[model samples]
Target: MSIKGSLRSRSLTSTPSSILKRPKTLVHRLSEIRNKPTEVKFELTKQLKCIFDGYVQKTESKEYEKLVIMIRDAKLTDADISSILKEINECISILDQKFRLFVEAILSIEWTSRGSEVIEEYQVFIVNLLSAHTYHAKMVIDKLVKLFFPGPDDSDWEDGVPADEDCAKCINVHALFNSLLSEVPMCQAIFVSSLYSHFPYYNKSTHIHEYYLHNLLWILEYRPNLRPEILNLIFSKLIIMDVNAPREEIEKYLNADEEMFLMDEETKSIKSSTTAFTQVNRHALAHTLDVCLDKIFNYFVSECHDSQTKEIIWEKAKNLYLEMLPIFDRLILPTYDIHHVQFIMFMMTCFKTTITEGFLNYLWKKVCNLNVAPVLRQAAVNYIASLVARSNFVPLAMIKGTLQQLAEWIHSYISSQDGFEYVNSDIRSHSVFYAVCQALFYIVAFRYKDFVQSKKNIVFLQSLNMAKMVTSRLNPLRVCQHAVVQNFAAVTRKYQLAYCYSVIEHNSRNTLPVIYLDEKGTTVTSDNTLNTFFPFDPFILERSAKKIEPFYKEYQEADESAETVMEETSEVDDFLLNEFPNSSKNKTQKFSYGSSPGFKFK
Candidate 1:
């Protein structure tokens, strides 16, 4: 018979069952493609495309097994492998829009069984196949990211959930990608570029867009050079979203008599009251904002070793931070978690000389703005005080200025010897005092020399007396007294006075005044300290107590005289005078100056 007639006869007899019974026969056919006649080569390409076309429907068929084995075991020339990939791509275009079946087949193939040299040889074909199918490439990347760096919402966040078959498949595929990324230099760029291409589609589907963002961050964690490009893309999109609000929504908000505007934290812009985004966008935006903040802050604080690089990053971050000020006002939205303070602290680590003065001024403006919520004002003040206490770079004037502002606020809100606002008020009075005292304690305990040398210590103590003056107005149920006493103890300890001892002894006479360290290792007084701070002078208590019958009255009278100050600050009575109240018996035991253990540096 002629060759055409013989080929027709062989095609008729080569059924899938017959081909699978002798699976190695298909490898032999593929191997001949290099030296085959033109007609035979074209015929082999058509046959390969047909096999690829059946990847989805006949995945369990014998023909499918034969095709997989041939691809794995065949020793074809580069040209022949390229032709096979071309045929597969053609099949991919015509058969599946998602390309899920083809991707699964390609990724699921046991490349290890083919040997390392074979995988190395076929690298071009594998990458080409994936790159030509963008959807498939993304699917592979998403699977890899999900398996490796799951976000907080991912089901795998909890430890007990069992991973099913799909998860197992993803693990195997991720391992393959990891090998490819390391072995093939171009593969990483291709993967990164594919993700960058999908930027425009972010707002189209929030979950998908968030997945893309999460994957971008995850990939950059291992491969950090791509951060600049990724950040530029994210920030640019945010700007566009801000500028692209619907015209009617813009007019409705901006043209209204009052002009109601809602701040979009992620976009760093104000939107109209009516322009509410979908829950998906909101959730995605919130997560994205958190991730972006962390990335930028980390880059600014730790990642950049070169001064020039850090400066560039700091400039970019500074702009973004100033733009997002409205979002950081967490008091405006009680549920919000703003990291502005922390962000500013990190910036101080880099641009201390340039940024500290400017940032402190900004914080003061925030704290002093009456239009802003008081809770947020106190928070900003707390940040300033913390920076002052911890950072030597902070100017003395700035530190003293922050303390003055805090003291002023304490006197106005917390120390008003009048009725404070009820618990249901927008800003609780005790909270303001708590914030001030906490900030003051940091400076007093950590930076005592500066406090005394600058004469701010006296001002700080005077401000603390407001905490005392308001205690009578505080409801017995209120607990600010405990916090106030602890803060007072810290500050007065610098002067070597037994403040905790005096206050504890005065409040509950029958209850022994003792100091004990709690689990967190802070010195604490008894439950009476929780009631109020009754004014007392421990220096007088040190004097012969038997001779002073009217000492309480004299001390209270002497406190009114500003000129009166402790003559001798003694450390002999710095600790409690007796043993600690046994923890096994009295849970409310307190610490006195003479009885307590001394400071522990470690």
Candidate 2:
């Protein structure tokens, strides 16, 4: 065979080039048909329908990865999407303006996986599609505001902006948004409000947040009459939102609109500011509230270094708790369950409050019916315990059934270990023993102090009796971390299910793991998102850990009389150090200290 023929001698003649050639022809044919007004219209409409169908198919939970693959494999992925978008350079390219609106509306569909690359591709496609035909794309401006300026509709946000993001595409979306801002006053005003109402870069020293607020104020100041109706509608949606603590700076922006607009004596055609502001936009408020609560939840639970910000956030969180109290009664209590419990618990965590009275009452009523399993109850108990600390004064309204369910869990574990043949493992017996010890510790040291210390201390709650059997093997400290993950998987939630998954991922893996130690020695799980803030109060854990270094020389001692250190440090123990070893917990700076248990340290 000739050189070219020799290469095709085998049956593998239809190579990558052949496959590309076919699709290339299809694309070429599609391009050529663009010249014919009708054919271009027909194919464009057909392609849109295909994209929409693909989008709908991809939305089902089971189809996440498969849809991503399909989208990746599609002939129109990426650049092809770019090419189709390019054809739409002018708003008037289509036959009708109404038809033009439909093209922009379709961009709202989520076309890819939640991964950065996928979201970026989809965002680029939308940006290009919109940027190409600004005249017709204004319908999407508010929707774009919802997706990009602050974040996307789903849980993941712009993710990286103004930080590790140096890309031009990653340039502050405010600029592109501002270009169209002057064109659409109402949309511009709302977009400005959204950005203004969002969390600000207080730490970054860029009063960009205030800048947006000022712009909105400017618009209301300048455009008093042209479309007061549009402005009213925009500001109306903004006020009704259920946001968390608005920054201390919010007073200026919130008050500015009424202060500036109401002054216009000549704009009487518009309704007075008081009349127009009938109801607040709960959705916008919720979005704002959700973000702040998320930050608080991270500080309360994530393992970052302590900072002044954490303290400020904690107080802000307390106010949010009072605000969300009604939600617990109405939405969380009657409606939630074991399936939704993790999400509910996370929301509670985010809100940084104890389970409300009505919520616990509702949960208690629901749990007794056996619809929820003991594991879920155990999880609820764990979540409840997490909220209590040395600094936290917790009040348990009702502990009756909580104690009984806990005892029942212990009994089941004991029964699981009935056979005497097992030699090496005490998991079944150990689990029961630990549960008993924990309950006793709670009821003894904290609740029934008199009952535990008095002559009636024996109170021979045989279930609570297992503390003696378990304390030798397990410790309350280890239980706090290990039991939490196992238990939370059993319980409920109202918002952000992905948070639980993120918590689990951080706890179980070694992804820059940092465990924040609370006053009670319980470890709060942390994640990558939380690295932004110092996760814990430095005064508590950081101070304690810091003080341990000075006493390292005293760690090794011959004072058997003084050695009161527990024989076991951890259930999963490594050999005790004879000299202080480098701690990987901190990135640098090792302490020179002799190794021995300093009884005072514990």
On TM-score, the candidate that comes out on top is: 1
What TM-score number comes out for model 1? 0.43
Where model 1 places Cα greater than 4 Å from the true spot, the runs are 1-47, 52-65, 68-83, 89-92, 95-99, 109-138, 144-299, 302-314, 317-350, 353-385, 414-429, 454-505, 508-602
> Ten residues in a row with the worst lDDT in model 1?
589-598
Task: Evaluate candidate 2 by giving its C-alpha RMSD to the native, one decimal.
Answer: 23.4
lDDT of each: 0.44, 0.34
- Candidate 1 local lDDT, 1-602, one digit each (tens): 99999999888887766867955667798889856844212224237565655655665355555655555445555555555555564554543443454455455444333434444544544555555545455555543444333334544212222246334433343455656576555566666665555564424433344434444544555555656556555544543443333223333333343423333445533441324654233333333343334444444444333456544455654554454344434322222222222333334333444566666677778766778786665666565655565455566666666666665765565435466364431113344555455555445444555556545565654554433532334322123333333434544643543244444444434444546676899997654222211111111111122222222111010112222233346432333322122223322111111111111110
How high is the lDDT of residue 602 in model 1? Answer: 8
Task: Give the C-alpha lDDT of model 2.
Answer: 0.34
